[model samples]
Target: MSQHARLPLTLDQLWQFSLQYYSAREIKEACLHLQNHFHGNVNLLLMLKWLDEAKLTFAPQDWSKITQSLGNIESLLRDYRELRRKLKVHVSDSLYKETLHFELQLEKQQQTALVNCINSLTLTDCEHPHLVEQYCLQLGAERLVRIFIQPVSSQSHNL
Candidate 1:
């Protein structure tokens, strides 16, 4: 074997290889899996995007809070999924339609809130802890919006 082939990859090496060794779709799937495991699906994606957009990065303190927020979102999604499944069988057609309508409306509201939250982020907020609180609230709100919009099946469509 070549010397390179015998070498164990470091985290940076593995990250680079993983990005190269698979197609973009495969890399995305792996990212989703790891994000879901570490931060739950909602916050991880949001945090990653938010960081990218703001040209900022997360400190350990911020990451811990974001993970906690994502956990809340995961629970909410689970409940909504269960409710949707139950509605399919137990509810009347009219009632089901109404429930779906409400859910869609709720989804829209969440989306708006998320957008507002993203809007709230500014470079100035980085300096103050109180501003960070407001920034996080907006970020959390936006994260839910992203979750509602990006189902696993539909994600590729956006790309």
Candidate 2:
């Protein structure tokens, strides 16, 4: 292996990959649905998509840590988003706007942390690209989303 050959993909590269993939009209809806309705980490989802594009696959056995940490990170972002939403209507208050802006930046930072963490993992085993695509099903993303729907719906209603 060459010195420049072994590093994992960076988050900025993943972000660019996502921007291009998510720009597709077909995927835009599904991606937004997973993101907005399910409160999924769209960036993570995009990372998986990018990995799939590269024909990379993850072992099902390696998923627990990833999902657990992602849940924790996503939970924090959810809280920040909810609090920011509550304060958004009071934009006349500079404090509220500034605080909301801070929260937005915090969410981005948290996501970057997640991307970095995933990149740091010693991901091994290679399967068909479908492995990553099938992961959401195996992970029960729909079921998880259902659990949080009432709160998410109420949040949406507020918007």
Candidate 3:
């Protein structure tokens, strides 16, 4: 645990944080890069960011539970994402937009499940960089960790 107190966050708070964070072009690109190249789950990465921002840290077992809860939804989201990508070039603009919309819905469902899983776990006030590294390393995308932890001012944004 660290000297700073941990903050409790609700699902709405996490969702808002995700929306704001994802609005940044650099953050969006980095997350998509992780998802595309390293098979990372963007919702999980956003959860990690939410935890970091809240000054909360979970144990490995807790993380395992969170990931397990997302298993089914993750598969569905991946399938939809792949379909959306495939449709981008081959389908009409409206059709591609519909696929993208459904994919976003699936992503929201995953985030909801994640927050529920997190609510049931014990968390502490600890440094987050190590935790972030542990997750990114597991994905074999350790080098991209900097993009997540970098200062917001250092990143370019559209919003």
Candidate 4:
């Protein structure tokens, strides 16, 4: 435990944080690149960003549990995402939008699961910096890490 205690995190906070960052074009591009190129889970990456921003830290086993909790939802999300992508060219604009909306709903479900998982975990105030960068690097997302580490002023232009 750390001296600087904060309120417990919530789904809305994590979702809002993710939406704020993901709204930036450069951040979206970086996240998509990591997802398509490195097989990164976008939700997990966002969760990491949320955790970092909240100054929270968790153990390796806690991470394992989090991932385990998301296993089924991850599969469904992947399937829906793939379907949405494939339908982009074949479906009517309205139909495509519907598919996209459904995919977003699935993403929200994943985020809810993540918030629950984190709530069940033992988290401490951050003892180290650049936790998000380190995790991205471990995933071999060096370029994407820069997007996260850069100042908000720099990213603001891309919003």
TM-score for each prediction? 0.35, 0.62, 0.84, 0.87
Better of 1 and 4 by lDDT: 4
Cα RMSDs of all predictions? 15.4, 9.6, 3.8, 3.5
The lDDT of model 1 is 0.40
Please report the TM-score between candidate 3 and the true structure: 0.84
The digit string of per-residue lDDT tens for model 4 on 1-159 reads 742245456777777778888998988998888888887888888878766766677876676787787889888887878888887999899999898888888888988888888777777777554657876887888877878866444332221
Candidate 2 regions with alpha-carbon error over 4 angstroms: 1-6, 24-26, 92-104, 124-127, 139-159
Which candidate model has the greater TM-score, 2 or 3? 3
TM-score of predicted model 2? 0.62
lDDT of each: 0.40, 0.56, 0.75, 0.76
Q: What tens digits encode model 3's per-residue C-alpha lDDT throughout 1-159?
A: 433233344667677778888898988998898989999888888888767655577877776787798888888878877777777999899988888778778888888888788777777776444565667889999888887876444132221
Please give the ranking of all candidate structures by lDDT, highest first, separated by commas. Answer: 4, 3, 2, 1
Candidate 3 error regions (>4 Å): 1-8, 127-129, 151-159
Q: Which pairs clash inside model 4?
A: none
For model 1, state the Cα shift of residue 10 in Å: 38
Kindly give the stretch of ten consecutive residues in candidate 1 with the minimal lDDT sum. Answer: 1-10
List candidate 4 stretches off by more than 4 Å.
Answer: 2-5, 151-159
- Number of the top-ranking candidate, with lDDT as the measure: 4
